[model samples]
Target: MKNSPTAGYHTKSAVLFVVFNRPETTKRVFEAIRIAQPKRLYIVADGPRRDYPGDVEQCKQTRQILSLIDWDCEVKTLLREENAGCKNGVSSAINWFFEQEEEGIILEDDCLPANSFFKFCDTLLEKYRYDTRIRHITGCNLQFGKKWGDASYYFSNRTHVWGWASWRRVWNDYDVNLTKYDGTEVKAQLKNIYNDDFVADAWTNIFNELKAGKINSWAYPLDFCNFFNNGLVIIPNENLVTNIGFKAGATHTVDEESSYANIPLIEIGEITDPVFFVPQKQADLSIINRDFNIEQRRVKHNAWHRKLKRWIKSKLK
Candidate 1:
């Protein structure tokens, strides 16, 4: 297995990098991967949007940065010719990743990982390759200064996909369309898991909107996929990834000023395996509550913000 979470260690598992029209962020994230120096690098890029005038140029620039691979790595690319947006673009990229790799690390243009994040996943991915209960190994920890146990990691029901690793076994059952489980019943699932009515209802509404085509996200389905299979996600005690794309152009994380934006990256120390395999119910509840509050406020505020912008533009016209 790869050495403990330390600097200057090469990553063993294949790394999948997903990019779109953000060359600046993509380059930064790519530099981190370059340091890790994974033996195999798989990149997937979504096509430029026809509606967005500069999307073609930006997408081209982002894809161009990917060809700067200088290490002795086997690199593969899946560049789309048509726009697939957030839902399809990302989920399909992951699907493409698993089609060749049994398991690997996945990062987006925005999810910048600490150098140790690669070893953290590489070691655990090998340790639990056959463990069905552990479906996810993610670098995202949203506890925000809260401590759960003495272990270096804790289990959570929430699937934080910012920078994560998973197996094909888990992805094989994934459905971005939520075809298996009825999206209307997500309230009950959340209620049972979190035991918080407000959190459950909030997530249920989000899932409902996602089903109704009002939203575009590949994460909720991934969460549901693990939830459906009674799988638990491994969250490191140290938050290893700092999401840097919480800007105006980002699809969900549009509020760059939000508290969750660009959280300080913390490299994990010696791994302390948690004794129990049960999900941290309290952590899950805290996550749902925090996420719900932030998302609800953002949605409400953004709606009004857009309307005001449109009104101002109409007056100017």
Candidate 2:
């Protein structure tokens, strides 16, 4: 990995790398970080499950691989002794990261970011550090081939967390339980943001599932917090991060054929301000139709199958 240093800009930004039992993916992502040569690096790893055989050894190997950080930098480690699962583990790790630093770039083990991703995040983290309107700066561009404008990036309501950066102030308001707002308020807020009843209802169900303890996820709650607060995410015009952890061993991403699995990465240049700070409706709708709608349909299909199975069992009885 060759470092593409932006002119007149040194890599002073702090980076937080979240990892688990995967040493192969961690090694790849670490190479990209090595190129950037950040002054400070924070590593967070969750403890392996005691019930899963070979997990402890794999976890040990992952941490050992991270020790290959040969750059002249200060490294901090937060290794958990007990398994906290994904929802609690990741959210708590992020909370710990923000406690020490004001702002920084965050990357998961599986999200292999381009060398340019570091520069793009470093620029925007300072640019919008005080702007409450913008909450997240994401390295994902799921808009397919569409460029919102001539700017290097655009505002989006969708929270693409593959690779991202944010300030402590924005993260301070993160509620994993969605405890700040009630159901009625959340639905009304989504309705206003999308201006569509069906879309609003669909999202309301997702929040309900989160509240009902049906889904164990950390990213959805962040999206909910940002949307409820009318916060915008900065999305690069070209995708700068690729997800390479969609395999059998993965927890959430099991589908190898996912459209978002191995998206091509492009080098992002210096950050440019968009004409407007508003979320792009066209891009949002495309995401809703392509990602959200497909997931919702899959849920409904599974529900139908379960219902049919119960009916047949009752008839046989």
Candidate 3:
């Protein structure tokens, strides 16, 4: 426990902080969370890859980072025997987390969340514990609109697992293996979710990689499961967390410089009401960028280049 606030709903719930080998980022995130000082903290440290010189060193450093959490809160650690990679590592970690508690918050090593984020997650988790319709309570606001309406967050078709919290009931539905939904069955729904052709194609490629065992994953499949079950994820009006893990040892993230250049920020406002959904046709990228005052020109340009490379690769194939 770094320091306790005026005592709110956070102390009642469990918070599972998952970290891998990135000790620096892990240290910062734990430092941030330590401020909130929840009652219980579950730290899951992923094991390192074999035959890699830095693997064992990174694991040791990661453990050291976990030790930095100053809270006397029931701190538990799950150390892996062998490298399970990010997919298995996170998947196993979250599964273990849910098994311990009915509900909890999840924070990754590189994500830096605002102080209010813990309160936001805890309040929503307690409020919606019985509501099976809500699959996740996310801290990252990917698409919150300007006008504050019925709820603080809007329901998103895509599940952005940046800094999020959820219950065991919702996570129990997650299948990392993802045996359901062959290509033809969920084609239209997939198209709806990824309205942009480039984005859709990228996701398709990722799914293919997962199926072919090229890269193992659980997040994307968890997203698919959420949608399939008609479950909603509550997102904050303000972007509470920023991702700092864009360098080596990261499986998905590449091009570090371009990734963090003009990161978007969200404007926080009062969320007096709770149950709201952005209308079906209200998810315009331009409107969202304008509302948030986000300088997304660079991000759009990067997306264009990514699409171009994908297009060229497709033509070559």
**Which predicted model would earn the best TM-score?**
2
Please say which candidate is ahead in TM-score: 1 or 2. 2
TM-scores, in order shown?
A: 0.88, 0.89, 0.78
Can you write out model 1's per-residue Cα lDDT over 165-190, one digit (the tens) per residue? 99999899999987776765677777
Q: Give each model's whole-structure lDDT.
A: 0.87, 0.87, 0.71
Badly placed stretches (over 4 Å) of model 2 are 1-10, 294-317
**Lowest-sum lDDT 10-residue window in model 2:** 1-10
How many clashes does each candidate structure show, in the order listed? 0, 0, 1
Instruction: Write one digit per residue (lDDT tens) for candidate 3, span 17-134.
Output: 8877788888878776777787788888878778787878887888886556655678878887688887888988999999999998889887887777777787788888998777
TM-score of model 1 vs. true structure? 0.88
Any runs in candidate 3 off by more than 4 Å, and if so which? 1-11, 143-151, 191-205, 259-270, 278-317
lDDT (C-alpha) at residue 45 in model 2? 90
Position 273, candidate 3: lDDT: 43
Q: In model 1, which range of ten residues has the least summed lDDT? A: 1-10
Worst 10 residues of 3 by lDDT: 279-288
- State the lDDT at 83 in candidate 3: 82
Clashing pairs in 3: 1-71
For model 3, give the RMSD to the true fold: 7.0
